[model samples]
Target: MPTVPRLACLLLVAVVAGCAGTDTSAPSASNEAETEYDAATVENMREGTYNDAFESSYEPLPATPTLIQDATIMTAAGEPLENGDLLMRGREVDTLGTDLPVPNGAQVVNGSGMYVTPGLIDSHSHLGVSATPQVGPHYDNNEVGMATPGLWMEHGVWPQGPGFARALAGGTTTALLLSGSGDLIEGRGFTAKLIPARTPQSMKFPDAPGTLKMACGENPKGGSGFPTTRMGTANGLRSTFLDAQDYRERWDAWLADPTGAPPERDLGMETLAQVLRGDMLVQVHCYRADDMTTIMEIAQEFAFDIRSFHHAVEAYKIRDRLAEADISASMWSNWWGFKMEAFDGIPENVPLVHAAGARAIVHSDDDLEIQRLHHEAAKALRAGREAGLDISRNEALRWITANPAWALGIQDRVGTLEPGKNADVVLWTGDPFSVYTKAQRVWMDGALVYDRTDPDRQPRSDFELGGPRQH
Candidate 1:
């Protein structure tokens, strides 16, 4: 017999040791059968392959103690610092101050005219699943059902998609790659560090919180499934949540007793159950204010929080309410009028929400748009300033950095140039808000991933008038 897998051996040992105490009642025919099944369930749970599977295997790239000197630093946590030195030791920001002493054995780069900020984040994106070549076979964003809480978006992610490299070159380090909202419940979203890897597992951010993708407006209803109308969609979702509650109760009862087999496993219901139990965050794709209100009511009934709403064009109308509930509005800067529900999109949506004391995230749902997320945030910042909101450049930068990081549940790890945070940072050639600026260098987890000055490190398709950046 082949040696038992390490996990299996440990699980077997636990089972033999009666960790939960195998049923001790007199073993009648039915009792024995139930006890055996219960033991098997416990073993599978311990193995972790039967449930809560596909754990991340991500490892940070090799890094060195490096200092980027004399740059304008926007931390996204406070006012910008001028002529500051940022030191990255190992995989985290070691220090940020003016005239910092260079650490021993640290490589130093002069960043005289560059601006450094936390790498941009897109809270709502479909980069890997939408695929770069844009062919039918490459497109794996949407599945065929309206109720597909069972499907996980990472399974469909094309790791080789060229978009990941392009996104990194554009200064985006982390992105929440969501399932296409073609289904009412398009399933779970995957948060990834934009690393070029062979599989999504390698790109997965370790210990990142999970999120589910749901839709309340036009996108989901277009599918040929149970929910063809908005009312139908609402009822369908409510019904699913009710079923998830029942499933959770069943599982809970088994854990409380462990005398019999647990309820039959359900791929779809299990995901919804995780949502109900608060193990997963829920982000919805909604445009109209009324539709968002409806989802809010459902959330209240279900006793779970809505993390954010993607493509919420009319989020401005309910900005106060959203702020009160602490729900983030992940939106495009100004792209609107392509559909009926999205027509109300105003350029000032992000800042208006921010002014109301709510988190406002600027996200890119399109592949091309993902590359210019900072530009999108800049546009919104200008619009908000023009509207007299008194927003600062640092605060506007948070729309693309800190706010989106919070939405994706990775704010503590990234979103700011602070000590004890991962060095996912971008060095820009000019003012990051200016259209003329380009990302001069990027470092993810302290590893220099892109350097525009180094032809070997730059992306091949970085696309200037010349083969390489002339500016």
Candidate 2:
């Protein structure tokens, strides 16, 4: 395996080469010097205007206008519709309503006794990085350093992972692949679409804001190190942010005038600076309520927002605080008591958060659970109803759809079945919350990526070919 520095150099080369189209030859001595000077100038540019060298190269698959008539639709943004008609025209939802006329040259599917919904989105996952048939070398979910924020999950993502196809078969259209919580500040996580591709860049979600995965509590405090205690954990995070602030200040001053020598670039601080500047979302892995409050206080001190807390088992205890802070709770339905910090988890955690007007999302942090996230949401809904909460099926559906999309900062593009949004639709054989139902057809950007009725349309990873579980 290549070292982190070597990987960064290769990524830079690829980005520069791709941007400067048709430049296949090496530059001469004078041209190389000029290129270095220009690179320095680009680096010192304004904060928000600085282009991401690793921007997504994803393009939706070609699709035609498709119409699914007479289905129960869960828009995830409003009440469920009965006998609704939805039309997908060229990667966008054209219309949705009762008895809508199908356009010319559109393929129509009879949806009698079926259900439709916006494709499920998992706010937390480790599919591509921690590839299936788990083994030592394939475990790319965590780095050796405890505070390596410079590392990006996209670098470790293997697009040929079989988990992508499993997720798509279970109706997951979009997912945020995160680093494990073994460290204080693990790395930058990335959002990806469940598209079978040869490279991670081809599966990246276009323009989705980057995510920084941080952690608190026992996971980070396990080893005998600097952050063996809760206080040490807090201090470590605070010190890192302070250092990033200084780095940002120095860069800003250098950008004011590019004539002089430029400051040395630190990859880790650059990522932290983006978080401080609100360009990237912060997703922390926190369990206990007190730890969650402490992290929120730290965020307040730094003036950076916490987007969501993963495995937030005790979030219900501070739902009001989370609501006020506008932090989302991405939690499991019934996972608890596996560790000391998770001992206080309750089945009604999501419901309590939702009742308090906080953003509540049902997330799957496990590889197998990610494929059945809809079922997890269904379990949470049942628990809430049994506890006397009047949560409807449509509202419960949002736990795995709109709520997770908002947490991933991609709600504007692919969360609801609204006109002009990406047509990421799932046709279910029955009510989505029902255990017996399966995703009959899954579409990403209006393209039919998975169809249970067609063996050829079902995607299979390269690893699965000629294996015992071949599709």
Candidate 3:
């Protein structure tokens, strides 16, 4: 079985690489100068503006031209405001009050009986990798090497992927593109805004910090033949971080003496160095309690941050510790029992984490589930309510909205509808918590991206290009 998973992953990477047209060579460094570089310079060496990553088809629409009024707005901050009005302009929120100026020629969307709020954000997702039923080469979420810290998930993204369309229509405006969980150190994941375009770059959230995906527990160790145990996963994660720490020090020493020359740049080490230097966020996948605790300890040892814990089914057991560490729990609502480690999962995990004052994020690990993230959030809220926790619908909405936005390190840009924030908003036919609720209209960067009534707003991937329009 382990060999089967490994072979599947290998074939997936090969297929994805072939479809991508060409493989970008990893940056090389000489061992002779593999020491003595400044921290800033070493950091600079790792960060480069890639023209390919920025390519996208999304265009921003007039911000001040759309007005949604007379709706109950769940701010995801405190309370729901009845008769609230949200005005957007040029990719940012211009106003969010009952009394607001309506610019001339603005598209006044009648929200008389609707609900409006921040667009949903999925902090943990493998949509671009394992999109739908198309397995094999279409799925390259994990790298083959155990030390593939240098791998970037964005490069593997199938821009024409149909998964993005479904997520956008389902009301998710932003998502963190993560590599698969086949490896302990999966690779780099970036926060992306779901905008229709020709490339992934066009879809990425501008200025969002890059994140590294790490895993602990069964996915990393218990997979038939690899680590084969919990302790093995811990060792892999710890060793990687430790190496990163060393890499940072070597580069720092070299930088102190520029004339001496810089150290050799190993792609893997360079990636880990970025984390040690706080240039990247750490996203870990773990389901069991002991594993989670082990991860926290490793993070402390290296003094690196763990941005969020994804698929944390047993998170409720350590709610206080998670809160104290300021770690966010990016979790599934009802997903569990599919594997042995996840057997202890309880639906109340999210609510319990939130009640303890820790950040709680709801994410779509599945393509179908990604479309209905709001419903998943609703389920989590219901579970909490059943557990006697004081959770409001508006607060629960944050699981898919503001909370995730924060976890992805893009809160400053698109999480909330505050002035100066990106105008990524969703309009629903009813309370999003209700199963009957559906997104009537969606906007990203003040541009109308999806509208239930507008056929053009509906996205069609390259794969479906020649196929008959489903409509």
Candidate 4:
């Protein structure tokens, strides 16, 4: 027989010992002991301390009250304002309007003829985990196993990746770093603020919901042995969820009566159980429309909601269904024909989804693409206009800003220029939809993180210190 893991063995022993205790009907201290034990167990389950070992250690930088005057402001929440002033009072937007009085001792910026908008947010990225220079050891975004829900994107995030600086330069202040779609259930993804730091945890978005990175269709089916076909993929997912349900039931039983001993902790099942409990968001990499519909069916079967579908090339075909389910689509602007499933992709996919009353976002799965997400959104906007769709510059900007933040479950904090939201603002050289425009200045939590005019403000990874290299 195979040897049991140490924790499992210990739990088995505890169960046997607890079962050997004498039964007592009297309402004595024994009943109180049981009640206290049950309460502790329930607390443990609710707090989810088992997964807290990788909690975020991020702390916002010291805020400086600053004011930008006479600039066009695209709030991403409404229409654009002309010659507006934005005040950032210590890590949050204080006010935004015309000719706002500068506070005492506030740093002032003359934003004449410039544009201000919320920092761009990428719904799908593999920056830190994949790393720059593209070497074997740096490719930690995927694992070999087919079912490895125990892995987390944060553990593999290399904080020194040069791509992070490039993304920041492009006004990408927040991003969702996801695991590669090489497995049926790859792992958990993480939301992070683009703050330069020594550790990944220091850059994590505080209190953001955990995201499970799942894959369907060609990617997971091609290499993984068991899930060789579409039907097999569905079956595999169903079976895994079924096992997770059983695991959750066992733990619930043990928690109801702690004297009977606790169930052995299974990390993979624990992650899935969080999904079942609606504590974690599910982001799947799906391509075809049929496959996406099937995945929705599976989600219904498992009684969980899919937050968004990454690289959903055919999402336009099922936009109504997605809207009804309240599922968002994180898609590329114009990529297609590289694979069989992506053959039916259209340039107007984003606008079509938006027209259907669904949340549509433009995402970058490639490192180079992440830096120009605004340009990608622009391309989709133009495509929509050419197709006779009524798309505006402000609405198109939401494809990169507010929409992605909603998909990542961080819209309440960093997606808009609201007074109570974080001061993740970017000043642009011109119209952000134009190719000639660039991010002149970028701020995160009211701190000047990047300035195009000052070389000192630009952060470079330690790896880029010795020689000139391409990021």
Candidate 5:
């Protein structure tokens, strides 16, 4: 059911905003006047001395202003608005309430009997790296060595893969596609906007903090290497952090006094140093409760923060401790007992963690699971309700949207349907909890990217032109 390639651009007015600057006063987009830079400054920029590159190149798909009326708007930040109107204008949400003044030439859609909510964000996914048509040639997720912190998952992503389109159709507007947990120190994971593009750079989320992928438990120990035992794995991790601490100190010394050339750049060591400086987010793959506790000890020893624990099936056992440490538990709704560490998983893992006052996130490491993240949350919500936890529908919705946004450190811009937030939204046919519901349309950055009714709007791959690709 793939649909279209990226269509031709349409001329539409967009209200742009200014990028966050270090200045005390935030400037607007209109105030971005061209400054005449000196020749020396231009030369420095050309030499890449000022800043890092690989910035976001995602532009809104060509679309006119859109207004939807008579729909239940799930703002996610607050209560749902019944029979409300949502206005998307110029790359931002204009307003969402009853009886809004529709701008001229705006396309008005009848959303009666439908529901609109903030676009879903998959906290964890492997759609792009381990793309569809799975085979030996397309496997780009895992690396050869155990320690690959310097490696970036985005570099290995195949943008033209059809999996992204299918994900978009399922209402996944954003995802943190990570490397598989085959290594101890996996790699740098990328938080990407799920838009079909020519390259990974075009899909990267702007200003998102870099994510460091580390793992504990069975997967790492199963490999035939130095870290084949739990003790060996823990010691190896501690040794890595100790080296990183020394690396951070040497860099600090060189920065304080530029006497000689800076210490020879160690890409892997530099990544670890950033973690030491609290610049990168540490997300670990640990299923067993004791392994998570060990990871917490390691974090304490190194003075780095653990943002979230991924695939932590046994997190419910230590929910209070996770809350005390302000760490999020990104777990699956029903995935249990696939391995030894994951054997203790329970159906109430998500809600129990949230009830204990910790950030509870539902993630999809599987491609098919990523397609219906809302339904996945519904499953957790039902289990919580059945167990007598007073969880609201909106609260359960946060598992996929807000909590994951917090985990990725992008909650300020997305995960909610606010006036100034990115207009990433999905139109659903019925209550999202209903198994019969389907995503009718999707928008990213206020651009119409997918429409179930229009073949020109739905995403299609070149490989789908002649025959079925997924089967």
Candidate 6:
């Protein structure tokens, strides 16, 4: 699992606590004045505890530490393990072998004849801001500018949006919150923990590297009175990336020698520099296979990675190249015929990608469909079988879990029920692949964030006044 630096973690905690009330700024290098808060005055504030051995000893055993035993573990690798035991502690997998010693404080959850995999991760979603479109203040997705790579998508995220809750109920734990496709260089996309909290800060993952959300083709060009050709879209993206390259060089020079006043910081340039430095990932929304190749070739020219191609309906045509490039394809199970460009899409798209040994993901771009991504994967699996392509049920499960996690650059942290990883797990009532299977419990960071068995545990947005009823 990727580890966030200690300093970054401390800064994040301080930023979150500052939301309560305070200056929130850290002490400076020159004038380090100590500020104190009176404990007696703050009666509700609890004492803080420090554990030097948190990683080794401070295993966060769940309030009801459930031990799931004798299950068909779809490790999302190659084969399923028969009769496996997964020891979940706090928000991570404490143990995942056979016939191990169950801890004293653990509650056993009988998992005989059940399937276990990681919670699904959606690589592409416009759920929260596009949730039925009530009004302006309620909608904060997709900035209108042509180039806004520096902007953070989380700032515009509506924490209480119904989509977040619905996705969780559907078995998604981690999601990449993205800006809508309004510009060629759409702003940043950040990974978020799908849990209900009072603030967005409470839900943002601590160390998930921010990614730049870029697009090609019709969405960016010819919206009203602009570049109506494919050349325009390609050129626009090229110009932005080239500028980003220059911006990175300037920042590096400034960082090397602080001789003069630093150049005024541009949020877009700062984010682009992260991409140039290979710190941030890139998620491009392109439909045609040719466009995918074009953007990827440009990425090679710029010397950065194209993490995943979102909505690549024609990806099956270029599955060999995608595998060679080591890029994942996030596509709908069989969604096609919506537009002329996407008319060539086929049900075999995912299966072809899988057959070519490339990452195939089934993502829900729609708010309603996102809740059943597992079923979507199953549909694709059947489609592949009908096409005479052999795809295992365990590998099909990766369409949502391991594949999407790998796409968003977070597979190591929460992708599988691997030991020494975050306990972000989901327990299904029956076979997860079956249509009747539903996520009974969803745990994030070892906390029972979503429990279908509990009425009050489900998340309800404050803005869901006249919205549709949720499960």
Q: Which candidate is the best by TM-score?
A: 4
User: Predictions ranked by TM-score, top down?
Assistant: 4, 2, 1, 5, 3, 6
**Can you tell me which runs of candidate 1 are displaced by over 4 Å?**
1-30, 33-52, 459-471
lDDT tens digits by residue: candidate 2, 346-380:
99999989989999999999888888888899999
How many angstroms is residue 130 displaced in model 5 relative to the true structure, after the best TM-score fit?
A: 0.8
Per-residue lDDT tens digits for candidate 6, residues 1-471, read: 356565665677835543333344656645654344344322111111123211112223245666778887777766777898888776567888788678888878777867677788888887666654547767777667667776667667777787788899888888887888878878878677777655655666765666789888768774764455788777777887788778778766755554344455666777777788888889989999898999998898889998889999999999999999899999998889988778999988998998999998999888877888888898899999999998889889888888898888778787777877787777777778789998887777666667788988788777776777788
Residue 402 of model 1, lDDT score: 93
- Write the candidate numbers in order of decreasing lDDT: 4, 2, 1, 5, 3, 6
lDDT for model 5: 0.86
Off by over 4 Å in 3: 1-43, 46-64, 223-226, 467-471
Which candidate do you rate higher for lDDT, 3 or 4? 4
Checking candidate 4 for backbone clashes, the offending pairs are none
The lDDT per prediction is 0.86, 0.89, 0.81, 0.89, 0.86, 0.77
Question: Highest lDDT among the candidates is held by which one?
Answer: 4
Lowest lDDT 10-residue stretch of candidate 5: 4-13
TM-scores vs. true structure, each candidate = 0.89, 0.89, 0.87, 0.90, 0.88, 0.82
Q: Write the per-residue lDDT of candidate 5 for residues 3-111, one digit (tens) a residue.
A: 2222211111123232232223535646665345555544333222244466678676776789999999998888899999999988888899998888998989899
TM-score of 4: 0.90
Clash pairs detected, candidate 5:
4-460
lDDT of 1 by residue, 65-100 (tens): 999999999999998889999999979999999999
- CA RMSD for every model? 8.6, 9.7, 11.3, 6.1, 15.2, 12.7
Off by over 4 Å in 4: 1-44, 50-52, 254-260, 467-471
